[model samples]
Target: MPLGRLLLITVSLVASTGLASAQHDRADWDRQRARMVEAAIIEAGVTNQRVVSAMRATRRHEFVPLAQRRLAYQDMALPIGASQTISPPFVVAYMTEQLDPQPTDKVLEIGTGSGYQAAVLSPLVADVYTIEIVPSLGKRAAKTLSRLDYDNVHARVGDGYQGWPEAAPFDKIIVTCSPENPPPKLVEQLAEGGRMVIPLGERFQQNLCLMRKVNGELEREPLRATLFVPMTGAAEERREVLPDPERPAIVNGSFDEIADDEMEEPLPAGWHYLRQAEIDAKARPDDPAIAFKNDEPGLPSQALQGFPIDGRRVKRLRVGFAAKGEGIRFGQQASQWPYVVVSYYDERRVWLGDEVIGPLRGSFDWIERSEELPVPASAREAGLRIGLLGAVGKLWLDDVRIAPAGG
Candidate 1:
């Protein structure tokens, strides 16, 4: 063969191989993503057909950091810089399901982490107004959503606690971050009968709460347990002052009969009790490690424990304590109610299990054995640990207790 002809043939062969490889890469990415959507979204009952389809079509990998691209489809949260996280696929589906958005409804999102949720929301609603306090994340999310042709989403860099006042009356609002209480501005912005799903509590344990505006009143119901980073911005500094002390204490004796006058005493402070039967760590001497502290009411208790935490295996952490405050102050807004804060940790002090249950409102609530929180996959085999980060006010914690699975 002539030299020029032979060279051209070789070049053609290389180009063909390159093209095939690229095609395979693209096909594999699609297949993996589809499997994730099937397992995490569709199987989980995110029944909005349009939302499901859009989630399947959107490439989550593109929104995550390059180092975490491989785990984009995993049913776990991924860090997206600035200490923020792109929520797991299941959480996205779960929260979205709670919204129950309609085709013509306009939605608002409080955290635009990686823009993944907003991207998911964009195609499901007529418009999405999302706010992110982190300037860098907001900018990056905006760019990513725009590049993907999600024009229906308007991403802004600002305080989400303020909500988007200009776009008042959103049909639905979803807050990705947890706040001590639902932002008042958000409630004011909701259209009558519109729903809002927010994670309410301290930075540790949060309750997934759904609220509806009825007759100018915001009615709320606790849905499930969850944990998320605290919402940041000016709202964080906005303190709630107690109402007039002269007024009578508000008491509903129906749930449990405790005198309203008795409820006025500040809870006890700085006490930890361990059950004798559960003290096997004394034999092991170094097995289960524990730590505790006390803070004022409405503050979160910071505690740390380490030993062994089995996945999906239920355990109980009974925190017997009282707060030293005039009484549990329900926020001026109905949403700001005091709740219990719990954290599961591994040996390294990395936050693993975080659960917040609320506005038990100065009542004694025990975390049931069956309700043991799951430690994140990253920290599961590292040895069980727990901590009391902080609390609402000065409270006495006595009989600090823990019960492992089957114990």
Candidate 2:
């Protein structure tokens, strides 16, 4: 064979192999994005079509570092460097939908950690002005957004508390980080009758609130209980809801403290997602209990609540709760069954591990269950999740409590 012709054939074969590999990678990413949208965004109940489309279109994997890209579409937040994280896919979708974005709207975003939120909003609105306090994160996010062709997102490294005064009167404003109170400047910059969705409250826990500038005053509506990194810069000066971390325990464990808003769903205070196990007010009339029912064996119904803890002082925890079950059976996985999980987290709020209580199968009238789990030496926070985890049948829980094991 002639040397020239042989070399040409080898080059062609190499190029074809590279092309095939790239195509496969692209296809895999597309499949993952689709699954995330259906399971984490749509099925989780974000109904806005535009929001859904934007979520579907955005390539989340591109926003994170290459090492973290593989886990980008898992419906959970991923670290994006500098003690920050990209908001979970559902959170990004839910907040965007709550803002009620419009094609002609001008949106302002505070805390552009990964710029992923601004990227999602870019196509949904006319413009997006985002601010980030951490210079490194802000610069990286700006570069990512630009490279991804999100031309409408304008990012700057600055304290978000003051907001972008030059671009006042934004049609919609979304704050990704939490503040003890809505930054006054942000509220002022919002256009009249404009909508704003922000998480406001304590340092550890907060309520995702939807606010409207109505007749020169803000009307606040609490959407759900959530946790977000605290807004830095000016917001750090205020310390209103700074509860003592040394004393960490469950609140409203008896499923009491119902919302008074007749227009909204009644969920136990300090908790969110009654859909997982809605409050059965009449089931135990005098003592309300949260109930979970899943006719479909493989679908899980769960609710989570986070509490501040100082693991250094509290080395072990005892979780106690009263639960009743009927026809409880495991789901597709053996690990999925009725149980209460106490998840511990490190100082950075990264999950360490979980101490789960029960597989509570079969039928039972009512019984009290308790278990003790050791806290990791580096743990600083804990979260409690209760429900039938991908299990079939009904489960009711009440009087849930977590305390230092010996105490």
Candidate 3:
């Protein structure tokens, strides 16, 4: 045989071998997905046949970071940059099962994170509207989901606290972040027979709570203990902050003591930094108010950290604050609010339980709200949480007062 002929034959053989190897690699990925569903999901008791099938079909590795692809099928959260993470596979399955999605259902997911949860729901439901607070994450995940041909999923970068009102009456809603309590707006958006699965509690300590809407009310049940990043934006801004219980009556409650230099991030002299939610008075980002960009999701940029009442003197307290909005737009005759919440904290500052005062309704006129806060027995200290509780708008605050109920 000629030398040239022999060389050509060797090259042809190598090409064929490479093609076969590529085919095998693709097959292996399918097997890995199958194994993940059976071992990480099905065996763990996620028995919605449709959910199990969706889990089996989704390319888990594709949704993960390049370096972490090998461990994608393993049951654990993976870092996807921007200080965000993808939830573990088992937890995802469990959460999905709890939602009990149907073929005709329209689901809303609060934390878009990696879009894995949305991807999982895409096939099981008719449509999925997912909101991610982190803009970069939302954009990236949307791109990935689109590229992977997830046409049924819709993605947006905004605060999930207000829920998607325009797309109100969702058949089901799922929140990945833990809020102090369920956001009132989300509950209002749930359909007559809808279900919402969310994690409720403090930053480090939280529970995966499930709530079902029946006859215009919520039937809540905490399913399990889970660790999730606290909900950011408005929900985060509204979280309870335990100040030194003995701190005097009201210092800088009038928003007058606000640091002039950092008006955009105005901190009234005595208030503590609980979360970095941007509060603005007017359109100026530098002005001060308990504000939120209605169109955006994630943690608020600034919030007024409240003063804690000494649980020692009395478990309950009286709280009041003045509030108004500048650019807040309410939903179709539906009321939104800026309110105060007083919650108890143990000696270590762990959350015991809380009671909401008034979600002072949104209005142009500065309204003064005063209410009694009933503290639970677990109270060593109680924090006065003040901020807006609505979809999108600018809320202004002045003259916040906290006192022992007896006084």
Candidate 1's displacement at residue 104, Å, is 0.7
Backbone clashes, each candidate: 42, 0, 21
Q: Where does candidate 2 have its weakest 10-residue lDDT segment?
A: 258-267
- Which candidate model has the greater lDDT, 2 or 3? 2
For each candidate, what TM-score against the reference?
Answer: 0.59, 0.93, 0.57
Runs off by more than 4 Å, candidate 2:
1-14, 65-68, 260-263, 273-275, 297-300
Q: Name the lDDT value of residue 50 in candidate 2.
A: 91
Query: How far off is residue 116 in model 1, in Å?
Result: 0.1
lDDT for position 250 in model 1? 17
lDDT for each residue of candidate 3 in 1-407, tens digit (9 for 90 to 100): 99999999999999999999989977998998887787668755678898888898888888888877888887655667665678878788889999999999999999898989999999998999999999988999999999999999999999999889998889999998878998999999999989999977655445566799998999977665465666889998998942355542555555545434423334444443223334345523343444444433222222334334455666557778767665554433344444466656565445567677654444577666788767665565444555554335656666678776767
Error of 3 at 47 (Å): 1.4
Better of 2 and 3 by TM-score: 2
lDDT of 2 by residue, 66-128 (tens): 877889888766767766778889889999999999999999999999989999999999999
Model 3 error, position 313 (Å): 33
Q: After superposition, how far is residue 184 of candidate 2 from its true place, in Å?
A: 0.9
lDDT of 1: 0.61
Pick by lDDT: which candidate is best? Answer: 2
TM-score of 3: 0.57
